[model samples]
Target: MQTEKIVNHIVSWLNNYATNAKVNGFVVGISGGIDSAVTSTLCAKTGLDVLCVEMPIHQAESHVSRGQEHIQFLKETYPNVRATIANLTPVFEAFKKEVLMEGKQDIVDMVLANTRARLRMTTLYYYAGLEKLLVAGTGNKVEDFGVGFYTKYGDGGVDLSPIADLMKSEVYALGEYLNVAKSIMKAAPSDGLFGDTRSDEDQIGASYPELEWAMMMNDAGKQETDFEGRNQEVFKIFKRFNNANKHKMNPIPICEIPNKFK
Candidate 1:
């Protein structure tokens, strides 16, 4: 579909879903990144009430400034838009105390990263439930259905990703089509876990676009994808993340009863 039509289609789909759901509004987390910018804008187009949240916890000044830029853009563009600021530092510390009690202090960075995500999720769901809104996700196709490049119970546990079918490149293109800010369109994608210029590439070792390209080749190019050459460096990264996070992409295990006994 054309970019305009695609944007309209997404907005329409969400609006219809919300109307049928009889919800109060739509809630989304804006991380000063492209995905959330595109999502909140799309939701605004449908005349639906949009809540854009900026969750910056102990971030540097630049982080706060960038998030404000996104918020400013959205406000200038939409009347029904409101960007809410929710800090998660205290919550992080409280939980850290509980973890120290357990004696497993290793992997603090990784654990804290995931903790931030889950905490954000809890806050979002609370607002979602109170407002009866659908929690719109910012995940792209590469991350959602492929390598699952998101925190499992945190960012990964979203209600719906409007851009789930679009690739990273396509997401930028649509952002342009929607007149999103240039800085936002060009900003590096991140989960803002550590505020250390982290990205999917830094965490997963391979960029999202490369992973999707690999998947495309595997689907269409047949056995050649298994052949040597193409960014072999990324192959290992993609496979490793996929394997390690299988549980996140799977259903809860229920042992099958082979016998018919009650």
Candidate 2:
């Protein structure tokens, strides 16, 4: 891809979209990940008000540091960029106390992890509403479309997605072009939802590159029978996630009423 042209295109698109919507700018949740770093930078390039929010809930130290470093970098580099820390740890703890935790340990943990994402989503939207800003999404092609590696109505809830078309590798290229903080660009991709150091690869059982390849193969009408060994394993993993999380990818189903009944 022509990196400069792509960057300009996204920046222009963001500017036009905000202007058309009559919003001041965008609010992005910075998670110390590659996607958010690249996304927030793009928003800043539009020369509009960009608010980078850090909403950590039992977040790992590395994630917090990287998020702070990126936020600082944005503030120093872009006059339109500003940042705030919501620190949702206490809110999360309070939520846990009020909810029922009676389920299989793994299932309960999964629900709570998703809750963390939802809480962050709420925080970003709160700021967006208060400031007349759109909630900018930080999802990429693989996570948003291929594997559905996001929480529905959580991180998946957004007013605009600037980098959803770009692959993970392409996002990294944009990060390098945008001069994103080195610490963030080098850190392994993570959701930071679990409050631990496990990388996205650990949770997905396949790296972005592997998932990208699998997505391409699936798009090209390839099947599991066509692959052998590790390739087959990766394909299966991709298929499992893609099939399981189709709900996130598809629009919410609405029951249609028969015209005669009306």
Candidate 3:
């Protein structure tokens, strides 16, 4: 689709979904990443009331600053965009202290990181309920489906996912077309769940482009060598992450029993 069409389509989708669902507006967690920036911008374009909340849990100052900057842009450019900052560091610290055990730093770290996502999820819903809004998710195709790189019931719990079909590159293109801040478009993507700053590539084992390529190959029923005709490392990492996180991607399975109605 053309850039203008893509923007119009997404904006229409947002508006139509809200209208059909009988919701008042959208609730988006602005994480200062390109995905959130693009998603929030699209939400703002719908001309519905949008609450962009920046929930930081001991995240980098750069992350918070960028979030605030994007919120400012939204407010200035769109009349319906509203934003606020929610500090979640103390809440995370309390959970850490309550759950920490002896000789389990690694386990605690992983659990705590996921807790950050869930905390933000809870916070978003809290505001959504107050305003009769839907939680608009920020995940793109590769992370949300190909690698399942989202915390279940955390960032994964949302009323709508407008960009779940777009690849990371597609998202970047949309971000640029939407006139999102260049700093956000250029900055490394991160979840900001960990206290220490780590890009998404650092944690995901492969970059978004590589993951997207691997997904394309996988969907085409091609072997690892089929991806760019040589490099299988990317495909290998993609499979590892996808297989391990399949539970997040697939809907819960249910058993069936035979009936005698025939």
Candidate 4:
């Protein structure tokens, strides 16, 4: 689809949902990453208030700072949008100490990471509820309804998603249409919980472009897409992240009862 049509479709679709939900607007986080950048822009353009927040942790040097620039752009471009920076280091530090003392942190890094995500989500919802707005999720098509790339109750939860069907590459294209700042459009994406820490690609072996391709190609409809043999790597990520982040996405495991309890 043409960029204009696609953008319009997204705007119209989201507005439909927002109107149905009776939200004041959308509350989004600007993480100095392309996904959130695109999401925030789209939400603001939809003629809804976009409450953009920058919740960075101790690792604020890399992408967090850049996200602020995008927020400024959003504020100027969309009068309905505004931003705030809420440092989450204090809470993360306290929680980190507790986790360290538990001695089970190694087995639960997933939990800790999701805790950060949930913290951001909590803040988003706090303002969203107060302002009667929907929380605009930042996950892209590559990660949409994905097996696992988000925290269950954390960043994954939202009242609406504007970029759920656009691939990372497509998001970049849209960024150009929206004239997103060069810095933000190209900045690396991170959860910001790890200072100069490894990103999703570094933590795993795959890159976002390839991963997005992998995800898009995986669909049976794209049978002719020819992803060119990244299946193993993609599956590996699928397996590893799914295994590690399972707790964040699934219900509590319960032993199967084969008619044992009457």
Q: Output the better candidate (3/4) by lDDT.
A: 3
Clashing residue pairs found in predicted model 1: none
Candidate 4 collision pairs: 24-132, 59-195
Comparison by lDDT, 1 against 4, better one: 1
Best by TM-score: 2
Among all candidates shown, the one with the greatest lDDT: 2
TM-score-better candidate, 1 vs 3: 3
C-alpha RMSD of each candidate structure in angstroms: 2.3, 0.6, 2.3, 4.0
Q: Each model's TM-score?
A: 0.90, 0.99, 0.94, 0.83
Q: In candidate 1, how many Å is residue 58 off?
A: 2.4
Candidate 2's residue-wise lDDT over 1-262, tens digit each?
A: 8999999999999999999999999999999999999999999999999999999999999999999999999999999999999989999999999989998999999999999999999999999999999999999999999999999999999999999999999999999999998888889999998999999999999999999999999999999999999999999999999999999999999999999999
lDDT of 3 at 222: 82
Better structure of 1 and 4 per TM-score: 1
Candidate 3 residue runs with Cα over 4 Å from true position: 225-230, 255-262
Instruction: Enumerate clash totals for all models, in the order shown.
Output: 0, 0, 0, 2
Candidates sorted by lDDT, best first: 2, 3, 1, 4
Regions more than 4 Å wrong, model 4: 97-100, 104-109, 221-231, 239-262
The lDDT of each candidate is 0.78, 0.96, 0.90, 0.76
